[model samples]
Target: MSKKFLDDAYNLNSSQETQDLYQDWAASYDDEVAENGYATPRRVAAALWAHLPEPQTPILDYGCGTGLSGLALHETGFRALDGMDPTPKMLEGAQAKGVYRNLKGFDIDDPAPLQNGAYSVIAAIGVIGTGAAPPETFDLLMKALPKSGILAFSFNDHTLDDPAFTSRLTDWVDTGAARILFRESGPHLPRQNLNSDVILLEKA
Candidate 1:
């Protein structure tokens, strides 16, 4: 990725201005992404659910823009869905779907608001790069789960090959903090000029 992308990705929590930018973008996000066919959220959600612990697992859809992942999760038989995002407009879009039990403004860098051991699965689809949360946030979220808690998330396809992020992810898997359940590379969305690698990480 370019330096700008990495900077935006790693510096998501650096200020309030960036947060506002996302809020502004949320309103037209669906229309903007529609051009790309919105393939990522569905693909990632499906891969994640396939490796989940159980059907009734309570899932936290981290950065769940417009409830895309939440809707997909529900269709896959996941119940007890909750959504969190920094943008109220984004949450508004998600709330309209009525699939989430709870929706709140969440800063991924500060996950203290989320209860510890309260989720069996956490999915942060399209929430790990450029103008989003950093990769370390995944570690924090996973730590919130109990042993054997399932974590299914995706990184932009471009980031999957980045050395810094890849190394960190590999470390987690190599150390047994998490196990790789599934990984797939495919078009996430064509309009957003994005692709992603959906990876399911299960906490051990």
Candidate 2:
């Protein structure tokens, strides 16, 4: 896909609209991603696993589209996995794999469904920068982690370069909301965007 197409994918007016679009596209979602080499999901899952304190800990996979990230985490030894995505069709695809113990719809904007300090590890792969959820959702997700909990997430190169977005993220790190574990920038998977960053954050 061209940069314009990738960029336009995230131009939704609201998160709800994005979910609806994904629900409509769920049937062909895997095929569509296969064409892109599944860059964001694969890279984000790898980066997350690499910095985890315990590879076998239970994890919550946010925006777990078609269970790609969930499958990657399971392959890395995370056996206890739960998935949350707003699109039910996507969750159905994930469910068919029988990898997640629990799969449910989630709204990143409202963190009420998740218990505080619940997950040892949390992942938001391929959800950011695509109008999948807002950056403020990060704060909500962070609050769901205990002190020193691990978080693995990815963002597109363009999103990383956004001054306002990066500023907000940096402020969280500065205030000890989350501590940086690792930040890697390179080709995502095989045939997607040129360069994206996978960041590992630890709840502080």
TM-score per model over all chains:
0.85, 0.87
Steric clash count of candidate 1:
3
Best candidate, lDDT? 2
Q: What range of 10 consecutive residues in model 1 has the weakest lDDT sum?
A: 1-10
Question: What value does the lDDT take at residue 168 in candidate 2?
Answer: 59
lDDT of 2 by residue, 1-204 (tens): 422233345677886777777877778777766776667666776676666636667889988888988888887777889999878899999998788999998664465767887787889887766456777767767888898887788877667776655775688899878788888887753575546788888878
Q: Among these predicted structures, which one has the highest TM-score?
A: 2
Candidate 2 lDDT score relative to the true structure: 0.76
Model 1, which residues run further than 4 Å from truth?
A: 1-17, 53-55, 107-111, 191-193
Once model 1 is optimally superposed onto the true structure by TM-score, how far is the C-alpha of residue 159 displaced, in angstroms? 1.9
